[model samples]
Target chain A: MSGLILDFEKPIYELERQIDEMRNFAVTENIGALNEEIQRLEKKLARLRENIYADLTRWQRVQIARHPDRPHTLDYIAGMMTDFVELHGDRAFGDDKAMVAGMAKLDGMPVMVIGHQKGSDTKENLMRNFGMAGPEGYRKALRIVKLAEKFEMPVLAFIDTPGAYPGAGAEERGQADAIARVIYEMGRLTVPIIVTVIGEGGSGGALGIGVGDRVLMMENAWYTTITPEACSTILWKDQEKAAARKTDCAEALRLTAADLLELGVIDGIVEEPLGGAHHDFSAANQALKTAISESFAEITSTPIDTLILERIDKFSNMGVYDVVPADPV
Target chain B: MSWFKKPNSGPKKGDGDRRNIPEGLWIKCDKCDAILFKEDLDRGFRVCSKCGFHFKIGHQKYLSILLDEGSFEERETELRTTDPLQFKEKQNYPDHIKNYQKRSGLTEAVITGKGAIDGRLVSVAIHDPSFIAGSMGSVVGEKIARAIRRSIELRCPLIIISTAGGARMQEGILSLMQMAKTAIWLTRLSEAKLPYISLLTNPTMAGVMASYASLGDFTLAEPGAMIGFTGPRVIEQTIRATLPEGFQTAEFFYERGFVDQVIPRPELKETISRILSYFPDQSMSPESAEEGV
Candidate 1:
């Protein structure tokens, strides 16, 4: 957090550093008069934080969402669930570390939890493929979700991926086929599903486990069909402005949590800490836990068939279009 | 209909080879680079006779190539794409859509309707790649959704010829959600036990590939089609290395057990018709295909 201050957050951090210095000086030099100065600076810091956090642009929110200190799927799982039993492998292939799936007790209720897992460091990121799952990862997710359906347990999927891995191996092993199977099966799965975008929900990788009765996103999460950089490159090959227009591309994509909610893409947003989920992990975890619990409480009581029907209806009614008339027969 | 008609005249006596071929009479194959007569190519269903390269034909040509003459009654032709994200680059999203619409002579990327193959009634949705790369947006999603529902209602076999660059960039999340939307409707189609033949053409990628395009009962592909979740350029950028040849091609997918078969263009209609013959309908046969023998 100290090392990775964003450009907009420099002023707030400088104020905070000044207050810390004043407090240290007062304690060392027996200068009690500095308390008033420290308090005044603290107030200014609070106001600055509020102003910056409240008016964060879509691109800034994307930065916060991608902050290295930001909590990952495993963090939320460890903080919120109990009696976790980790499952592994897609049966036909080796286990994929990028996607974590297993049985866990969510507030004493039996549930199957699955999520895309990114890493905290370079070595672990390499191991996790930066949370961009390959074909096996999606296949493993499908297996776990299918198991949940068989066991009549509610499925909680944490989506946090930049996108599926765009590699030769992923393509060779049928990345599209695996993802398509998951979406196809999950659409009609009898068990209840609640998907929450914990970080970055990018394209079909997220949608592989994203179709749920209640699709949610954390406050800072940005979900999109393609990342802004990719979008900018594709839309504006003008080389010079492609880098500059990346922020505009993010805004144009309408990928923020609030934007998605407004667009009716996501069901609701779970609030994060003032700065972001990374600043206060406990508060972020608590908010996510409450959101999941509340969504489960609302959906768990519905009959399975009705739940399945409503889930299908929820996705079926998502696109915006119009029908005027068919061709003359 | 116009393309189906033979050219009123033939090519001139002089052959120009690669340097100066007559523009309208001769066409070059993208794969083989062999000069081909337009009439011969059209007569072969756009499959190059020299090298057997399957050219990406328009959806109208696909309708004529697959469906029986005068048997197609197009449905959901009026569905239109809205600029949900208000996306703009050099041009406004709606204006770009209008440009593609005007150039491709299509209201949207795909055309959904009921058509006949070998006199077998079938529901079909053919994608035209010339229209915005046949990107899937809200309109394409709704039309395909309606097509699936119509198939279930009519209890006819469904055929969706997919040729897309995946989800539309202009529509953003709405375009992405169309994957799940189409997948959900496809699941409903499967539950109805109606056979779905997803015919993959050149350049199917990303969102569309990860949804309805890959969920077909008989997932067929035209020869040498590029079918994958991510395109080669993106994969090359991601991996930061040169790709092995034949990656994500139809033959590559077939080797990997994803594609059931890679049929040539000339035999596509016969292949689909032969497959449809196996499942007439539930009403026609008391024992549905879903029930195990």
Candidate 2:
């Protein structure tokens, strides 16, 4: 209902609403072709929705990245992955829930899936802290990443969040140290890694599980060094200005999937339906499947060492540019 | 109300109270004989610019100077005291908490946030010495844990600026528990492959120094900063003899290979920036000349 809040399922909702209206009208009138017309309209609506979501603006794409209806880590595990067995605790402290990581099957091949997940409603969000992981979350994700390496499984990470929770309790738990460890470990990881930015990939929160052989972004997703709101606040010192300049912030931050791809921050983009993934879950899932499969197939072709070396090389080259001043006439 | 009230001590000529003149309140710098205004001394990041004598800095000022401009967003703003143990050895826990909160203007000793230094995103946690001598308490531990997790989530480097007077006695064993809690998170971070940098400021000792603070990919200390698990006085007392000169100073630690570098405040940001740039996708030699190796 809010202007900035996008309705990802608009097209589907509209189509369904129209179908209900049409059926109600048919019950009152003796229109013989109404049934046939409704059927045709439904088919047309489905295809049109896909066409609309195929390409989106950077800001629009950011909306999809944080879409509540999109599949989270649990949804992905339930749908595409199988044989998941979650490991618990860092053995040093208690388990943290902001991160859900475990060993799972991807097309019958073993892989580690680690991701940030925000709950559906208020209570769940409070418990998950809107998917802003704390120190324990990072530790949990690290545990799974290490386990994957020990078992020789590929790593798949789904990124979605504003940033890590800046709570006092988290700091006492050594949040910064835990994050540092994860980055260092991933940099030296020998296994193939596939990272996908499914939603709001904000700063270190996204980066925690982001290092991989192939980093992909959903067509309607975003990734950035900091949240737009945070950026705006720091730059303007005015929360109102930050809220007003959300679109501009998204553009400047280069958070969109397309932008990231062009900037070499991401290897590829997974297309969604016309109005976004929420419009047609099946089609979106299929696109994700194909992209993941093709990428895995390509990377898995080489020896594990070679694959890891290539991945490291790929990441190393990112954001590296030699500046050449213009020659004086 | 009258525009001017009568003086409580009755009208007096000149009111010759030299104490009200705001003068002669200077702390002589041990390194330099310069007598500086207490306010000016406090403003110089607790360091004497003339002789470069490092003084103790409060936590907030330390974090501000350490982070890039406009990058900090204080975390855990509210979670305050609960008096878990009702400690009352020297002073009641509640009164101590109130006094600390009033003096430090902070809910806890540790302040955590997301910051950027040289455009490299980092999650920072700093312990405030002003708050009960920067004691490690439950809230401090919680803030540090959160900061670490945030860094891991952001995939940014993590830095903890430590300056503690050991553990918080008020919380008793609960304070010591933070050491294990922090270490566990550090282990998890290590497994995740992120960089953790620890900057030891003035006077990092006791439980905090021994725990996660010592575990860093690159450990740096400010010039003349005191950094050790045990205080020099304790060691000297135990041995019943005087300790070596500059026993726990940053230079001593550096000389002993415990610290990577003893950097100045002005160069701290540049040093961190260079370190971050070194780890970018390129595989440059660790001994690259650009980093002053």
Best by DockQ: 1
Using TM-score as the measure, the top candidate is: 1
lDDT of 1 by residue, A1-329 (tens): 33589888999989988888889999999999999888888888999999999999989988988888899988988999999899999998788899999999888988999899998988899999999998899999999988998898889999999999888888888899999998888899899999999999998898889999999999999998899888998877877788899899988999999989888888899999999999999999999999999999898789988988998888888878755666321
Candidate 1 ranges beyond 4 A from true positions: A1-3, A238-240, A325-329, B1-22, B281-293
Q: What does DockQ give for each predicted structure? A: 0.59, 0.03
lDDT of 1 by residue, B135-254 (tens): 899999988898898788778998999999899877889999999999999988888888999999988888999999998999999888999988888889888999988888899889
Worst 10 residues of 2 chain B by lDDT: B12-21
Positional deviation of B208 in candidate 1, in angstroms?
A: 0.8
Per-model lDDT: 0.85, 0.68
Ten-residue region with minimum lDDT total, candidate 1 chain A: A320-329
Top candidate by lDDT: 1
Worst 10 residues of 1 chain B by lDDT: B12-21
lDDT of 2 by residue, B1-293 (tens): 33222223222111111111123346555556565565776566556768887655665566567776776666556446556544443356788777666655666678787666766667788876667767787777767777887766666778899888766645533454455456556655776788888898877765677566777889999888776644565456445677777766778767756678888886777788788776542222223223311
